[model samples]
Target: MTPAQIIQAIEGMEPAMQRAYLEQVKTVVGAATVAEVERLIADEDEDGLVALLSLGALSVFLELARSVFIAGARFEVKAISIPRDLGRFEFDARQPAAEQWVSAKAEEIRANATIDVRAAVREVMGRRRRAVVWPAAQQVQVSATPMVRTPRQSALDLLGRVSAQTGSRSGGVIGLPGNYAQYVLNARAQLLGGNPDEMRKYLQRKRRDRRFDGIVNRAIKAGTPVAQADVDKIAGRYADRLMKTYAEMLSKAEALESFGAGRDQVYEQLIAQGLDRDSVTKTWRDRGDKKVRHTHSVMGGQEVQKDQPFQSPAGALLRYPGDTSLGAGWSERANCRCSAIYKIRRK
Candidate 1:
């Protein structure tokens, strides 16, 4: 049957049957129409698409006619009344009362959970590609290597290779450890070492109380009693820290999947966990935030204080098990201190 006929069928169905009819249409027509419905579902300036689908309204008939003309299955779309956001609470012209203000903010938080399921469906459809596996040969070679690196080291090596191949100048790039200021500063303390470019930059600045001279002397002073084992241990520790931090953030964002949350829900939960809500507000409010934002559903939040004894951040990331998202999100506004970490998969 044509799309219009299916829509007409939906309109004619009793309220009890409307939802069921829609589902059946999905089965019959396949999922491709999800995109078209999404395009039409939220159009404001256009005439009432939702009202037309009403059982009493002839709009349903008209819509079904259109669908039939296009030779597509008909379906009904429902309005989801999500809570309004409270984060944007303003005491401005409306002068909403304090309770109203709070409610508004809360509602806003709830509203953020709103999502176009079709968007996800579209993404899934577009991403229908086979999984990747490191070849068995590669795994065998890795096993034979002299050093049995932990999973963390393996990940770091992979990251380094990715950075090298992609020529990424980002802070986390592997080989150029000194590109990061923290590592560079540590190197000056003679506790770490990094890429020459990074080291040179740190060296150009004046040293405090000839500290650099002292470090250089320590390096060259004959019989200074440097222990190769100690140096290896220290460097290894630094690498461990970097890998741990990266992995922890990455794992938390990955956890976002379990919650099946919409964008706003993610913002609220993350904010409660210690992320600055306002920061996420600004990002989501803008046109460009979606590309940079991602989510992880970690078990812990900001409640886990810095002084508190805890496992690595990776453990914390797994503390929460709700929903999360990656990509530029309306949720990751400015002043949002939440870091959404993720990696890309080539399909």
Candidate 2:
């Protein structure tokens, strides 16, 4: 069949079947080729995408190549600290372990952030109450109807519901305004999901290893290729480095996102307590380290009223750091370490 016909056939399959078929193709041609195929398909280069696939008539050659590559990959993996008997060279059992570790770390970070947020809010509220003394009559009236009396259990229940909700609402979780609850939920979800761009980079590096060039050169020079066992021995030398780099990036991004969610939850609660929106302000504070992004560094000490959004130097409007609200891109939100410092101006 023609390349376009092959593309159409693949596209017509069910998603699960399509994935399975593509995975088989990847084994034969490698991920770089598969990625190129996907890009070609997206760009409507039907003739280009199936150049590798069009060699399907040479199934014997394809299978031999697949076996050779897999043997080399498996041999390399066995020499490493990774678990043996992974069944498929491409399916590393350690990947799930990495994801699980990130998930657990995110939960821990979220919990700690919640504690810090609560303490900060309490300290601010206590100071405000102590500094403002009311007249006896007003004190009696205020005592009769205390502000910020939402029960902890009730708030938690509302938070659970709001977080699970997919739609944006004007108010949520005891009347927090303007999709604040949704923002927190979205951040948490993004954290657990990890960054797709980072994953793509990892796969690209794995598929395009320069070691393959040396293997091909040797194969061309020597009339016979190296033994599969020998190729496997050296092929996985860099696996550990790639895995470590990816894990670190995922962990850091997840932690930042979870912590940001916790801070957002605090702000939502404070807003629910009926503070004067006009009197409450939030200031962006950058860590000031060299690692801070240029866009955020310029945002340091930028203050906005409770209802207003902070405008980043890149012109992205954010409700807070790590916020995806207002359609902020991954570059603007991922691994963000800045924070919002809130203040209440008493009348």
Candidate 3:
């Protein structure tokens, strides 16, 4: 029979016969595809329990929920100020002790910072998973037994699976999704050793000022040779500033990663529930501010299939903002305020 004729013939069958025929089709297409087809068929059956289900409504609800979650889920890292007395050392540029002291202080800062950021990211991720998954589960209507409350351990295990790293750059660490954990770690390392150009410029300008000169002269006159105490004081001040800057950068990056991960998790669950990947589309939305990168600003409103990546003006391809999977560099991913909006097409 022709394809249309076969569909008509199947429709004419009694419900029991239709199910039996579905089983036969299942043997051919495999369980997953057949499951999806059954869901679509149920969606179209006006008298079927699935007719009461609304995937479109669920999509809308999830979209709104994710948007709100992304907007509100800002993880702030507290500024870590190195104590002045934390690593006091005698002034000697040639001494290894000076280097050791600096190294120790940086290690302490990194350890403390990592702990704070990780805890905050995990907490946000927990909330995000719940916000996306549970609601979708409740909305899904199936002929099988009603969805049971997943045991806490089971839920965590599932999340662990979902959060597994897909490749070198994608997935891993629940809320700090993708290469975000590594990104933050790298940033912290850089913050300690790399002299930021902005900081260098600020220091240069400060050194040219008369007030800075006076401070150095006073330190020398106070029996502190070569103004070692003054040097430490200046270093401490800038260290605090840089730490604050790093904290802000980390908070913003985590928010973006968490948002992307949460969105991906929700759609993944829907796909598992038989939603067709082809029926979904994701759109890029730039925050529409001067702070947005020029390349991303031009990408605003770009739409593509859910499985495809969006190409930025600079030729960076990303599954979503802050996505490093496609080789998007720090310039493209850092402090990105862009958002992904998903749409689902229902028959």
Best by TM-score, which number? 3
lDDT: worst 10-residue window of model 1: 72-81
Q: lDDT by residue for model 2 over 1-347, one digit each (tens)?
A: 12233223222322332233233323433322324433443454433432433313323322332332233233323332322322223323234432343345335433433433333223322322332222343343333332331233112212222112432211111111113323322222222122333223323444235554454345334423333333322222232233233333333343344333333333343444454457667788877789789999999889998668899878898876666547666688654667665566766
Q: Compose the digit string of candidate 3's lDDT tens values, residues 1-347.
A: 12233222222322332233223222222212323423433343322212221111222222332342232221110111212332432222223432343344335333443453344334323332342111222233322232222333222211222212331111112222223333332222222222233223333433133345455444323422223233333433333233334434543443354345444444544455456778778888876779889999999999999889999888999887766557776688666767776677664
Once fitted onto the true fold, the runs of candidate 3 whose alpha carbons sit more than 4 angstroms away are 1-226
lDDT of 3 at 45: 32
Instruction: Tell me how far the alpha carbon of residue 286 in candidate 1 is from the true structure, in angstroms, after superposition.
Output: 9.5
Candidate with more favorable, higher TM-score: 1 or 3:
3
Report model 2's TM-score to 2 decimal places. 0.35
lDDT of 2 at 345: 73
Q: Model 3 lDDT vs. the true structure?
A: 0.41
What's the lDDT for all of these models? Answer: 0.27, 0.39, 0.41
In what order do the candidates fall by TM-score, top score first? 3, 2, 1
Error of 2 at 150 (Å): 62
lDDT of 1 at 91: 15
- Kindly state the number of residue pairs that clash in model 3: 0
What C-alpha RMSD separates each model from the true structure? 25.6, 32.2, 31.8
Relative to the true structure, candidate 1 reaches a TM of 0.21
Return the candidate ranking by lDDT, descending.
Answer: 3, 2, 1
How much is 315 displaced in model 2, in angstroms?
2.8
Off by over 4 Å in 2: 1-240
